[model samples]
Target: MGGESNRSLSLLHESQNKINSSKDVFLEKCL
Candidate 1:
């Protein structure tokens, strides 16, 4: 159970980083 939770947490963090990078690219294009 603990390992499963850690895996999901890492996945969530990875997705969050992708979202943040995409947002940065979008802002750059808007400017």
Candidate 2:
């Protein structure tokens, strides 16, 4: 159970990073 929770956390973090990077790209285009 502990291992599964850790895996889920990492996946969430990865997705969060992807969202942030996409936001940055959108901002650059707006400029």
Candidate 3:
């Protein structure tokens, strides 16, 4: 159970990073 939750957390973190990077790209284009 602990291992499964850890994997989920990492996956969420990766997705969060992807979202942040995409937002940055969008902001650059808006400028």
Residues 1-31 of candidate 3: C-alpha lDDT, one tens digit per residue: 9999999999999999999999999999999
lDDT of 2 at 28: 100
List where candidate 3 sits over 4 angstroms from the true fold: none
lDDT digits (tens) for residues 1-31 of candidate 1: 9999999999999999999999999999999
Where does the lowest 10-residue lDDT sum fall in candidate 1?
1-10
Task: Please identify model 2 stretches exceeding 4 Å from their true place.
Answer: none
lDDT of candidate 2 at residue 31, scale 0 to 100: 100
Q: What is the C-alpha RMSD of each candidate to the true structure, in Å?
A: 0.4, 0.4, 0.4
Model 1 steric clash pairs: none
